[model samples]
Structure formats: C-alpha cells, structure tokens
Target chain A: MASHFDVAAYALGTLDARGTEAFEGHLASCANCQVELFELQELPGLLDTVAETWPDAPVRGAVIYGLPTKRRRFQHLGAATAAAVLVFLSGAVTAIGFLGWDGADPPAASEPPTALTRLDPVAEEPGGVRGSLESSTSHAWVETTPEGSRIALDLGGITGSTPCSAVVVSRAGETTEIALFDPPKKGERVVVSGTTPYPVAQIDRVEVRRVSSGKIITTLKAPEK
Target chain B: MTERAEWTESRQSAMLPRVGRHTRAVRPVAVVPDDPKDEWVRQLYRQFANQLSAHVLGLTKYDRQWTEDVVQETFIRAWKHADKLDQRPEMLRGWLFVVARRIVIDTHRGRQVRPIEIRGTDIAEDRVGVSDKADSTVDAIVVHDALRRISADQREAIIETYLKGHTVDEAAVLLGIPPGTVKSRTYHAMRALRRALRARG
Candidate 1:
C-alpha cells in the first residue's frame, strides 16, 4: 500500500520505478492524493527557481562526433608557394575591403564590413610599461562615409570591466572620440561600433583608453594614404 | 561529401522539433561589455548562470557547448546593458531568459554558425510567457524563504530529492537516512512550505 506521504515524493519526481507504480495504483483510487497532486504541481518550477542561484559551473564544453571534417585544399603546394599565396590572399583581402562584399563602389558606412587592422598593446606609458598587457587582444577598423567615419572595434582580455572610449586621431593631431563602451569580463571578447565625423584616409590612429584613469590600453595605426 | 550533406540535413530536421518554425534573418549586433559596475559579471554569474545554463541546455537539446555559448553571450549582453537593467532579481531573470531564447533561435537559423533547421511551437511558448517569467523569481524567493522556516531535516530532504533531482532512494543514501524517513520528511516539508507560502500570500 502506498502511504499518503507518497504524494510529495511523486510530485517531486523522486519516486523509484516500483514506488511510482505502486503510488499510481494507490492514486487511482485515492481522490485526496489526486487533489493534492494538482495543488502541488507548481513545486518543481518553484524548486528550479531556488536551484538557479546555486553556485555551480554553468558552461561545459561539448564533445562533438560524427561531423564531417574539412578536406585540405593546398596539400600539393610547397611551403614557399603557400607563403606567397598567403601574402597574396591578405593583400587581396585588403584591396577588396571586406570579404563577401562586392560592388562597383565602396560600401557606405551604414552597409557591410571592411578589413580589420590589429590593435597592438601600447608598449610604453608615462609611469612604466603595462606589464600585464600582453595577454589581451584587440582589433579596429573604419569605413568612410559622407558624414565621417564609422569605427568598429573587437576587444578581448580587458581586466576590471572598465569603461573605455575608442578615440580616432587625425594626422593633424586632432582627436575625435568615436565610441564609449565597457568590457564585461576579464579575457572575454566584445565588439563595439561607433561613428566619427573624420574621413577615413585622414585618420592617423585609433586608441582604446580607460575612461576613469585615462590610461592607453591599445592602439591601431592606419595604413599610410 | 554528398553523404555528409545528407546526414547533416537529416540531423537538422531531427533537431528542429522544439525550436518552432519561424524563419527570419537576425543581424548580429555589436556587443559592448560593461564599465564601472564592480563585480557585476561575477554577481550575474553566481545568481543566474546555473539556471540559465539548465534552461538553455533543454533548448539546445543538451548540447553543452551551445548551452555555454548561449549563456556566455546572454551574460555579456546583460553586462553591456547593465546601466539600463532593472537590477531586481526577478526582472533580471526574465531578461536573461528572454535574451537566451532569442540567441538560441538565432543560432537555430544558422546566423552565428552553420545552419541547422529546427521547427516547433516553442517560439510562441517562449514569447508569450517572458514577462510572466519575472513572477517565477518572486515565487522562488517566497519558496526559498519558506524552506528556511521549515525544519532542517525536512529542508535537507527536499533539497536532496527535489532540488538535486535525486530519487528518494538515491537521496536517502546521500542524506544517510532510510528512504522512508526521506519521504516522511519531504511530506512534512511540503506541507510546511504550502503553509508558509499561503501565509505570505
């Protein structure tokens, strides 16, 4: 005989298979247990609420299987030829502006993408070199528009989740603040898009600096026009 | 190559049952991280990550990496919009769930990675209940407070069995008690919790 206490166990999904079978048999005749089950139906969802705040590791990497692997395309090319091909590809990528964008004219700032230039860590600062800076990575690029330039930045490895601004500097030493954003976590990548009124060719460099301390974190130098 | 393509298509069709069929192109947005909010990401992780992961795990059909990716992206978006968020636990939970749902749908449509087709009535389900989701946090807080008011033994019984998803027998072993005692404690605990929640209401 399944006791009345079986209601809670059944409701909570904690019953063993035999226990569950017995309980269901008992529940068939027990109108009280039937009513109680309906009343306690919200228990599991409520329980999930409490479980949400439990401090456990959330992200786990998946083991993938059975997916088709890519076939190597350039296996026949020698190392020197491969190197030359890579150089040509990069140069072609730059000339084409952004991969997958083809048109008779360069795209408007409101349209698609452009080549992203690497933003190297600023090697020197006033007080000393940023010793812990080598671990971070960043990239920036700009597109020219009738109004000015549209700057897009990809950033990673920023510590302290600090508020920072992307500043566009001109060859004439004038500076324009293009974007203001904050890094969400240490060593996680973030993308920011902002606009500046300066033309792309006239731009000299872009700098990402901390808003609070005004410390320069990284810089991207534009190609010479 | 042809066999692989056919296999991928079959797998995609199998996976699409719960995703709901609504095909629309969603452009990926630039995500800016947080600024000046001290330990906000850490706090978000502690309070929401476990639940978010579980919720997303179901949506992704237990694909752990995709679950992690969705959760990570949701948190980053949350951090980016920290200043704009309500910051209340219930509201934040709702926001995170909604954002995570959108990410899953976007991923299903092959926006961020290779496309996989998922079809179902799920999007409507996800959309309709989002705002109502905040009430869940409220209910959780109420139930959690009620759990504290119950006897320690009763609370542990519920935790081991209900919260941890253990069978009564398994929880008995973990709690170092007989299964009968575990059931008895859970019975009493549920009664006490119902009373406590009623009192609160």
Candidate 2:
C-alpha cells in the first residue's frame, strides 16, 4: 500500500532498495503506478539536462593501480640507470666548477641579510592618522608605520578579478607592477619611504585601479608614512 | 627484523592472489573476445570527461589542469571498482558523478588549513547544459527549475541521497534527522522531482 510519492521516488533512484521494492510490489498490481514509473523515468533525463551546465571529464590513471607486473622489473632497471646518470653528471659538474678552488682555506660564512621589521601600530596615536583608504574589490590593506616614514600596502585581497594585475607606484614616477596568476591572500605591504609627486603620503592620490575597468576602488592618504 | 620480514612475506603472499584475480578478471572471456567492458569504460570517459571537468572547475575555481587531475582520479577509482561497476553500467553516470564529487570534497578537505573559496565566475556559463546532457531525451531544465521551487531542505535531502550517494543513515547523520525522516523526505522529494521533470517533458 505505497503512496504515489513512494513510486515516483523509487523510479527517481532516490529511494533505498527496500523502498524501491515496496513501490515495485505496489506497482505490479496498479496500472497507475506503472504509468507513474514511466513518467518518472523521464525525470533523470531532465535532471541530466540541468546538470549539463557543469561538465566534468573522467579522471586518468584510475584504471591501473600501479605498474603492470611485466613492466615493474624494467621500471626498476630504468630508475637505477637514471639515478646513476644523475650522480655522474652531478660529480662532473662539481669537479668542473670547483676544480681550481684551494682546499687550504674554507670560505667564511657571510651573515644573512636583515629582514624588514614591522612597526607596532599601538605606538602611534589613534586619531593621528586622519584619512584611511581601502580596496573594495578584495582584502587589500595599507598600514602606515607609527613614525609616518613608511607605508606598507598588502595586496593579498585581490581574489577574482580577470586580467589580474597590480602595481605600486610612488610619486617620483617609480612604478613596479607585477602580474599575479594567483595572488597570496596575505596582503603584501609596500613601504612608501618619502613623498615626491604628492605633497603628503595621501593614499587617495595613490589610486589602486583595475587595469581592465580603470575603476579606482581604494583611495586614502596616511598622516605621513 | 625476523618478525618484520615474516610479516612482510605474509602480506605479499596474501596480496598476490588477489592481484592475480584482478588481472585475470580483465582478460577477455571466450564469449566476449573484445571485452565490451573496456569499450564501455572508454565510451563513458569520452562521453562524460569534458562535462565532468567543467563541473569540477565550477565547484573549485581551479585551473583546467587541476580539473583534469580530478577527472583522471575519478576514472582511476572507477576502474579499480570496475567489477562492482560492471553489473551497474546503467547507473555508471550517477556513480561517476558521486565519485567525482567525493574526490573534490576529499581534495578540499586534505588542504584544510588553507580553505580556498571557489569564486563564482562566468567561465562556466557555456557549459550550463551539462545537467541536461546527462540525460538529453528528457527536459532537465524544467526539472531543475522545479527543484528550485521546492524547499531548500527537501532539495538537499534528495540531492544527498541520489546525486551525492548518501545512505539514509548517512543523510540522517548529516541532516541531523532520524533515518525514518530521511527516508520519508527523500521519498517525497524524489516524487516532486520526478513529477516536475515529467511535466516538463
């Protein structure tokens, strides 16, 4: 004594095996259920059409778990040969490069280059910075150092813009634009050491515009970073 | 060292027979010399590869290469499970869709530390007919539109059971409902979907 709902559900492959069996038992005696099943069969076809928008291809290397038994031995041999060749090449390159080097003295270890230190935001007065600029497109941020001598612009926020590109241009006509395929979300900060083109370190004057649209989303100036 | 060697030897011996059986199963039988199964798999790939790749790209916002990798992985799983699949070739498309979705989920989950949000873009606009293409004889768009009309919970229940291959128990756990409720909701949702698809057709 299944309902019409059960029959339709079974036909649509949404019902479990037990439900499907129950519906089929009802369907065996009821012409209405049979007709409904026929009708419901069309649903999968239609659903397929809606799913068509998202086309996907079958994955590869799924057929074979690993190398075929026959090929395994040959593969091992080939790998050993490759390793030997690589070792020989490395030795030859090292011999050629360091052939004339004196063994008497070891080179002194040079100190690593100093990393740029980030300034503490708490040290600066809260209202000392008058204007603020932010990018509307993504999570782009510009932080002014407490000393007002440098500004760090982290361009990590530009997520889904086509023809994705960004540039950091100073007032002195110095422009450095880098084309990013997948820009990091953690914003990269650029320091504005001094003001040349603009009187103050005004981010409002330093426009961050999309190359394609030419829309300036963020515009503001630091107190004097 | 001796115990370890013995354990390794036993494991290898156990696996050898299973591997042999697998290889033998792929060999052509006397009745079907050409092995229609292999052809069937190839045809499945040719028919669905591009569409599946598009769907994956839509969901992940990944490059075409990554989408291809997903597709490749899905097919590899299919081949490994070919014996189970042979009896259900008619259900192959549904199984592949489920497998592909699982792979996407697993890939995302594996990189849990960096959760990448797939941004919706117009890149997949042209391939919008994929759902329909899964079964072209029927009006898939109508069914889709009708699905939208249903309650979101109902729709999700139906999708989880069928498209996503969740068992009633699993769906119940996921939806935080009783298994009986899941069964009932799935039954009702399927009925609605079938009716809508039929009406459109």
Candidate 3:
C-alpha cells in the first residue's frame, strides 16, 4: 500500500523506508514535491550555519564502530523513572564541560560526587566499545560499566527462535558465557542485554555465538586505546 | 621494405600502454606500514569533516561532541565498506549524509525515551525552527517552523509521525498515542503550518 504523502516529513529528511519510497514514487510525477524538496534542501544548509555560533573544536581520527562515547543513559529506566530522571538531570546538568567546548574551570560545580547519578558517564575504558546496526539482520552495542561488561544485542540477524550464547573473550584467550536468554519472538528486533563478570576494560571482545552449532554470528571488538 | 613496415608496427606495440602496470619486478618501494584503506578514510575525513560537522550539528541540535562522533562513525562505515562505495566525491558525501542521518534519528529517538531530552527538545525545536524560517522561503520550511508553534501535543504527534520519520503505527507505539491520533496530528500540523504561513504573508 502506498504511504500517505507528508511534505514536512520529506522536507526534514526524516522518512522511514516505506514513506520514502512512496514519496519518491509520488515525486516521479509530482512536480510540486520536486520543487519543494529542492527548496527545502537549502534549509539544512542554513541550519548548518548555526554551528558557526558554537565554539570551535577539533574532531580527530574517530573510530566509528567504537561504542558511543557520550549519551544520557536513561534506557531501561522504566517510563516513570526515565521521566523523573530526565526532569532531575536536565535541571541538574546545567553546565557540564564538554571537551574543546570551553575551559571555564568550574570543577566544583561540574564534578560534585553527588552528581554521579548514572546520568552520563565518561567513556573511561582505555579502548572504548562501539556498535553497528548497518546490517539489516543485526543490531548491537558493546559497553563498559562500573560493575561489569555489557553487550546489548538486537537479534535481528535471523528469523525464528534460536538459542544463542553471549560470550566475552579476553585478550588472554579466555572465554566465558554471561547469560542464557529465552528465545525472542521470530523476526522482531528485540534487544537482549548480557553482562560478563569481567570488567569491560579487561574484555577483548564480545560475540554472539549460536548454541546449536557453535557458530559465531557477530562480534564487537574493543578498539585500541 | 614491407618487412621494415611490419617490424616498425611490432616495435610501436612495445610502447603502447601496458595492461599489467604492477607486473614488472622492481625494488619494493617502502610501503606505508598502514593499510591504504586507512589512508582513504583519513582523506575522506579531512575533506568533509567540517561540512559533516555543520550538517549533523544542526540535526543533533548542536551537541558538538555527538555530532563529531556521528561524523566519525559515518566515515568509519565508509571505510569498512570502501569496496562497495563509489569512489566519486558526491556519492561518498551522500552516503555519509545518509548514514549520519540515521545516527541522528536513532540518537533523537533514543533521547526521546528520556525525559531530559524532551526538555531540551523544545529549546532545540525553537532555535532550529526559527533558524529555518529566517533562512528560507520554502513553504515546507515555513511548516517546519509552524509545527513548533502549535500545541506541543499536536506537534509531537506530527514530529513522531512525520518529522522524526516514524510511521503511524510506529509513532503510535513510541508516543503511547493511538494510530488515529498520529494521523490526526499530521493532518492538523499540515493545516496549521499552512494557515500560519499564509497568515504571515
């Protein structure tokens, strides 16, 4: 079925696959949308100028597949807690010094031990972890935490319920199973979290291995520090 | 002589371009210890880093560090799939934009799940919202601004369903609103933005 035409959606470059294909189909014959997409193109460029007001910072050699270096971890907080936490954090996190953002030197305000509330943690592991979802069949993120090593695997690599083992491999070549998960529903992008007893820093890589044949489906390696 | 002409023709063949440029045995020039692929990625990063930073900075609402990360990740993807990519600069730029955009949307959606992101979103919406208005005359750009001015509920509806690129059912699930509400907000958003823009004119 053809998706409904939403010009604003198209203009913002924010359309899901179905909507995009449908819009392009409509655009093939609709001169109007063509004209508008061209005009709207300038909007992103204009918005680009907003970065000028932002302080200059250097982005060096970046490892894209590395685990996200910065984010507010409100996930799995439950809706109510997430909301409450969001309310608390936004007001509390008034002026965290971002690297290259500024050097105001307000250490007391920025790093009060009380503010260490799991709101945002620096990616402190010498070699940070990164995730990839570019593959249509899989989604994953490898992360380090104070307690242990964690890997969030969105099992989309295959259809049907399959038993899979989440294992962490150390640089010294030790393998340990972290968790056994119940089979996720077929063809759904379900994220199942697994943790190793090993601290994330010590782990060399995390892999999702099929239990039946012991085939390694995918792996997330810790980047060199 | 006829034999001389044939000899000359054969001699010219030797000067013609060779198919196996690397087939000759020469002293191995010192190869860089690094993979040539790494060099390709570095070149791409140096060429488009500033532009990608600017574009993604707007999308990420000027979270400069996050924008830089997304930009870096985009290049990394380009590097990993270097064989699959067209070598043309425009194609690489488009590919980077597409990948970076998905990261932005994912980041945006992930942020929406948290209350903190919801708070700053209004501020972001208004800043970029007006910035878009100040810059262009596209009717859709006007609507982009007008969506921000509408009731937050209605705007959220449109944003989830439309701007943030969610389908009706998906947006419904994400927003905890009904699919019908998603459709209605989209309708109301379109009408309001059109009306608002017309009123301005």
Candidate 4:
C-alpha cells in the first residue's frame, strides 16, 4: 500500500490515471485514504469562494475552432499557427482599414458611422440605370445634367476574348450608336457624352454590348421623375 | 471461479432484495445524514470555480463567456459525481482541479469539431461587472487590508504577481529582482495572506 500522501495526491489528480486507479482500489478499503481525499477536495471550494468577484466568461466557438478541421489532431500546432495568423491578419486589416482615404487617421470609436453618400462608382455601377448590358467587369461614371447626362464606361476588368460595343436609346425611341472600345484596358475610358436630343425628363435607357459575342453586359435607365 | 461468481450474485441479490410479500414485510434500511458528503461537494464548488475561471480567462486572453461556460460545466460535473467526491474538504479542492482540467480539455476538443461564435461585446461587459463586484465584496476588502498590513515587499509581490496576474518574470523585471526571488516572495506572501484571512474568520 502507498503512503497517505500518495493516495492524497492521487485523489487530488496530481497522479496519472493508472496511479489514480491503483490508489482508488487501495482507497476502497482504507479509511485513511478516504479522509485525505476529503481534505484535498475542499481546497478548490475555498479558492472559489474567496475569488467570487470574477464572473465566468465562457470562451467562444470561433476562438476555439478557428483552424481547419483537418488539423485538429495536431491541435497545439494548429491552434498556435491559427492564433498567430489571426492576430497578424487582424492587426494588418485594422491598420489598413484605419488608414482612410489620403492616409487620414481612423476615427476615435472602433466602428465608424455609416457613410451617407456611398457613391463610389465601382459599387453603384451594377445597379445603375443600365441593366445586364452594363459591364460587370468595368468601372463607370454617370453625370446627370439639367438637359441630359453622359456616362463614361471603362470595361478593363472584364474577362473575355471577344470585343464589345454599346448602344444608347432614349425614352422617345431616338437611338444612337456609341462605338464600343475593343477589349478595354486600364487607363482607357470610353466617354459617351452628348446632349440628349429628347428632354432630360424623357430620356430613359442606355445599353452596352459585347459586339463579338452579341451580349448585353450593361443597361441604364432614368426613372420617371 | 463459479463459487466467486455465485458469491457476487448473492451479494448483489442481498443488497437489492426482491419486492414481493416477504420484502413488503421487511423494514427498510435506516437513512443517515450525509453532512460530510454535502459539505465536501459545496466546498469543492466554492474552492475551484473562481480560480478555474481566472486561469481559463488568462489562458484564453480574457474570453469572458468561455471562461464562464467552462466554470459552469466544471461545477455541474462535480455535482453530478458528488458520490465519488472525497470526504475530506481539502482533497475535494484537488479533485475539483482535476475535474476542471478535464472539462477544459473536453471544451477545447469540442471547439475543434464545431463552429463557435464569439460575442465580443457581452464578454467585455461581463468582465467589467465581475471586477466591480469583486471589488465591492467585503472579503476582498478584508483581504486587501490584510495585504496592506504585510511587509511592503511581500505586499508588492502579492499585488503584482497574483492580484494583477503578472507572470513571475514580468513582475521580477518590473520590480528589478530575479524571477526566483519574486516567486518565493509571492509564495510567502500568499501564506501570510492565508493566515491573516483565517485569523479574521
């Protein structure tokens, strides 16, 4: 039989599982072992009662399983690597996001208030007056005037081997053929600027086409004012 | 071997008598108060939950909600296995430590297999509330006073190492001392604090 201290240690969980089981077997008939186990178990309760001020904050799932499932067996390695990458990426993204346009410092609050006018051309172009004929892979600008409006199409970002063209139509059935640039590249802007022969309020639609494949990628329209 | 097996069967049958005419005529066994058992379970809960929570929080970088969940699960498991808990209150503490450790391992493993959403905002608020409540507790104030009554070096070591959660090396560096010295001082300070708190009680 082991000494009282050994049994106590086993009961306390300081011993490995085999040692604990052996000790427990001995403890079944030994009154001394039972007494010691009782004593050691109280230590946790005392510490908890004293440390009552800290509320339990449960760990979140994202923090636990951020790594891919395949690497779970090597959790130590996986967690360490994932944590390092997450921390690095978070810091980098935060730093970049904070550096607003023209290198302005980020706002004091962590989250910035939503911008009122989100008129960045790349974002608004897809839902612009032009429908599917609008170039998905291109940048566009729409400038409205009291009399008419002009749109500059830049289809540099589109991926295709074919060439494209554009056609503009007014609400009054007046049609105009705006020549499309072939395979638009960076630094090339297709300007379709002209006074609408119809009144500004009557002009309705604009369309861009892929001439080689005969596909309409962009379309724009003016809602009845 | 057959005799041993028959003995085991008979023991089981004796412990669990048949529920029939003869059993109904026999008196039930006496019910005894298990004060030690109840106290031991209570003590285990009291001793381990907060420290486990603190350790988990520190390990996980103050993930407030996860710490709470782990603590809650640890205690619930302890309660469920109350029969297995040691009778000595001191041993109960260590038993709970082991349980808490297992709970942590299980939690970590489960997290690997599942998707977890971290609610950053609520955790921050919960931590603030916990700290505020701890500060308001009378025992905390008493402990703080006892801590102040100790030697300045001992008090400083305790404050920086345990209360402030600084690593021994970090506290040593801050105090311009060696890590070993810092550790020894903190240990002695803890002993002193324990004595003081016990005396007050």
Best by lDDT: 1
* Predicted candidate 3 versus true structure: per-residue lDDT over A121-215, tens digit per residue: 33444213322222223334444444555554444444336787767787778898865554566544444555566664466666667788887
Global lDDT of each model?
A: 0.54, 0.42, 0.47, 0.42
Candidate 4: stretches off by over 4 Å: A1-225, B1-136
Root-mean-square deviation of candidate 3:
25.9
What is the descending TM-score order?
1, 3, 2, 4
**Per-model TM against the reference:** 0.31, 0.27, 0.29, 0.24
Best by DockQ: 1
Ranking by DockQ: 1, 2, 3, 4
Q: Residue by residue across B72-113, what tens digits does model 4's lDDT show?
A: 655554544556555565655555545454445445545654
Name the lDDT of candidate 3. Answer: 0.47
- DockQ per candidate, 2 decimals: 0.12, 0.10, 0.02, 0.02
Task: Assess the local accuracy of residue A46 in candidate 3 as a C-alpha lDDT between 0 and 100.
Answer: 34
Candidate 3 residue-wise lDDT, B1-201, digit = tens: 453333233322222234564532221335423446656766777777778888888777788787876775566556556655666776566656655765565555555543333332233343332234432212222344454457888777755654454566688899887655665566566556556444432
Q: Is the docking of candidate 1 incorrect, acceptable, medium or high quality?
A: incorrect
In candidate 2, which residue ranges exceed 4 Å CA deviation? A1-4, A49-225, B1-138, B194-201
The TM-score obtained by model 4 is 0.24
Candidate 4 lDDT, A65-89, residue by residue in tens: 2112312422455665555534432
lDDT of 1 at B71: 85
Winner by TM-score between candidate 4 and candidate 3: 3
Q: Model 3 segments beyond 4 Å from truth?
A: A1-38, A41-225, B1-40, B54-62, B77-87, B94-102, B112-131, B134-160, B163-165, B168-201
